[model samples]
Target chain A: MAVKAVKRIDLSLAPLVENTRRVIKGLKLHTICDSGNCPNMHECYGSSTATFMIMGNVCTRDCRFCSVKNGKPQEPDKTEPGRVAEAVVKLNLKHVVITSVTRDDQDDKGVFNFVETIREIRKRSPGTVIEVLVPDFGGIEELIETLVRARPDIIGHNLETIARLYYLLKPDSSYFRSLSVLHMVKEFNPDICTKSGIMVGLGENEDDVIEVMRDIKEIKCDIFTIGQYLRPTGEQFEVKRHVDEDEFQRYEVVAGSMKYAYVIAGTFVRSSYRAGEYYQKYQESRKG
Target chain B: MKEIILPELGEDIKEATVSFWHHKEGDEVKAEEDIVEFYTDKANFSVKAQASGILKAISVKEGEKASVGQVIGEIEER
Candidate 1:
């Protein structure tokens, strides 16, 4: 295990950070920022942006790298979709992100909430661009089609790590299943931007990271984000090493060569970090 | 004269409501003493006086929103 030190915490976002906190609490919402102990929470929330964790905070699977609580899941909140849409209006967000813990225990696998949430966002704030980081839905084709029919701007399903580490890291998840999920999204509708992300620094080398990128590209992924994985709790997997800044830059260069439409790779770059900005840029380039 | 501005509370937060005031104009306040409390969208926070002095001015009252970098109050050094 490597000794780690905290770096790059910005103190300037305090005032706005308060606003975001108040709204999330008042609305009774759960965010990955709070659940995963995301380091960029302050920066993202203070900017009046957050990735809303829908379904419920309790996850069905015990992924080793994640900090979201795992247990028997609760009944899906029926009114959640409307409340999420209301939050978007109050925040006046131009780009909105919605993700969830894996709810494998539920029939339909909580797909209805996702569809309803997207519809509510569209009906309430048609101008706000919506992005969803969804589960694999047990590789169910009909469920993927149901979500695609709702027409979210971007659909993200994180592979989370290299193929070799899935058994140890995401014990219940299969690397092939995740790749097929990305492929299916494109298969369902080619226009929706398909995205995925992975975390490095868990004893994987640069080649391992690139191999995942190759798989993502082979599936015709539109956006790829890479970030350093910080151990969220003492009990989770210990950090093998913090991939240095030079290594991140090298990954960026290599990923760029692979021709991902948008490649955001950095130590602090979470999957949805500055997501709206990249989507906007991708839209502009498409016009040009 | 030391101007007391709302300090950075958290990331990307833009505005806060003046939840309450612990001090009023002409009250002597010690440096870092809680003078006002603010309500943000997510949480509540108490702000401190910049330096020990008389509370010379109160620019924002309770239940009002203060934008970041706004001068909320002024402290006249004793």
Candidate 2:
């Protein structure tokens, strides 16, 4: 039986895209936008915002859905922080996002890189808000503290999928460890916003999604994002089914009923896409 | 006369600044040749000449912003 392919609607080309693409390349910087092939690249680049992927593009782990290359990563570029700072200044962004590939091979799992990047961004773009989306360090206290001490405005660790599917989808990562990391963020500094995101359409039910939401919320997570899991590459797991807009809406409704300040559920919503806009939106909502 | 309008850039960008002109009016330009470069917040783009012609009239000046669908210059049939 032949199944009709469902096409994903993509952003139309905008005049701002070329310039943003060139700038990211010129700065010798990497964005999760390009690395992950994020659906919101056009929207993010056009708006002059990007989630900068620091350290390097190669990851130590081969998460099933992630498109980032996995293998032997080169030595961490010492000058990377300076260039990231320069890119933040060049983009003139009010809120800057910095993320990285997992470097479990390293002694400290590349935690210091985040520390340096935050310091450099602060030094160069003094007014920019810094948000760091990180990986779980097996709940290591010292590693998590190193990141928290950086004092980024928001700390994000993505659960990526539900607890039941973790062994198959993200075998290398643990569901509970990620929750503990988010919990540690609030425990370390309640003022700094803690956030986590999960993906749907990987054969999980609504109950699993809600269960993850409740777990994260119990850890005092502030921002929760739920998006459909689009297989990043042909070699990755095929998309089981396209979770329609109505399901995403339902997820949003359920998540909003909970305590999170921001609950974004959409097909194209990623942890870092248009994150600055969400941050500002939350602040405005608070004021009201 | 053929008009050269800006192509779609990205969803968030409405206008872009003409950063520089690689070919000015009266310069013989080849089709598909990069004739001008534009700048936005993210990067620079060198727009290719749509048709081989004598660069005719440039309406958008250097250091000026051009909105999407706005004609920036004219190319005369050579």
lDDT for each candidate structure: 0.82, 0.80
Which 10 successive residues of model 2 chain A have the least lDDT summed?
A: A1-10
Candidate 2 global lDDT: 0.80
- In candidate 2, what are the lDDT values of residues A1-288, reduced to their tens digit? 112122221223355667777788898989888777565666678788888998889999988888789999999999999999988888888998899998888888989999999999999988998999998976798899889988999999999998989899888899889999999889888889988898887888878888887887788888888887776546787677667778789887887688564788877788887888898887776577
Winning candidate number (TM-score): 1
Mark the 10 consecutive residues where model 1 chain A has the least summed lDDT. A1-10
Fraction of true inter-chain Cα contacts (below 8 Å) kept per model? 0.03, 0.03
Alpha-carbon TM-score of each model against the true structure = 0.78, 0.77
User: Which stretches of model 1 miss by more than 4 angstroms?
Assistant: A1-7, A10-12, A285-288, B1-78
Query: B1-78 in candidate 1: lDDT tens per residue?
Result: 877666554334566678788988999999766777775443345556667889999899888888876888888998
What digit string (tens of lDDT, one per residue) describes model 1 on residues A1-288? 332423332334566777887888788988888777676676788789999999888999999987788999889999999999988998998999999999899889888899999999999999999999999999999999999999998999998898889889998999999999989999999999999999888778888988888888899999888888877766688777877677788887887677764677877788899899988877775577
Q: Per-residue error at A189 for model 2, in Å?
A: 0.5
